[model samples]
Target: MFYAILAYHVEEAVAALTPEEDAALMTDLLQINERLYRERTLGPAARLGATQDACTLRGPGAGMVIDGPFAETKEQLLGLYVVDCATRDAAIAIARDLRRVNPTAVYEIRPISLYLPGVPFPVTPS
Candidate 1:
């Protein structure tokens, strides 16, 4: 089995989620999390705040925590999901379902490279 990360992001959804929508989304997340828990494979990952809320490091031994980031870019990272699946398609399936929440919401689905002891990687044909 391999691991993958489903990075969820939104542009202006911050504090934009309606009370009902928020509750619904939370319920969906809980259901998914519970399924993953039962499977004992997939799992719920951490939810990181926006870059603006990040404690950024400027220079050596220098850093600061701010309310907003300097960069003015669209699509802010909302949250993420970690999964242990047999294939990328499986992970993509999960990511695809999340699209139901907000069709415009972006998700970066990337695999978590695994390097197990004594397991050799594939060799390319020269």
Candidate 2:
């Protein structure tokens, strides 16, 4: 099974870190990513740009493009990792290790349901 791990952290906390501390943290994350790649379980992973750079589009097709942060929450989504694992337990283990390095962050692990090319997804109206 494939799992997507969404990482969230308080932007202020991150901004408060010393330059050395921030560099060290980034190094640790790089090591973790390298290990994941070596284990062959890693798929896509990336740290997003600052929330200020984000834009939200709502209502209908093409929608109304709104330029600004999407939410008023203190914590913002930092990044995500997609991993192929044998079970949910295995995925949780990976998340635990990641949390050890990034102690202040919260992670949400969810299984991925991939659709084949040209396959249609069934949508039910609320």
**Best candidate per TM-score, number?**
2
State the TM-score for model 2.
0.83
After best superposition, candidate 1 residue 120: deviation in angstroms?
31
lDDT for 99 in candidate 1 is: 74
Instruction: For candidate 1, report its TM-score.
Output: 0.66
**Which window of 10 residues has the lowest lDDT sum in candidate 1?**
64-73
By lDDT, who's the top model here? 2
Q: 15-103, model 1: which lDDT tens digit per residue?
A: 68799987887787677677777977665465665566554446456565455655444666667777777888887777776676546
| Model 2: per-residue Cα lDDT over 12-124, one tens digit each | 78878999999999999989889999999888887877777788889998799898776566689878999989999999999999999998899989999992323556855
103 Cα displacement, candidate 1 (Å): 2.9
Each model's C-alpha lDDT? 0.66, 0.87
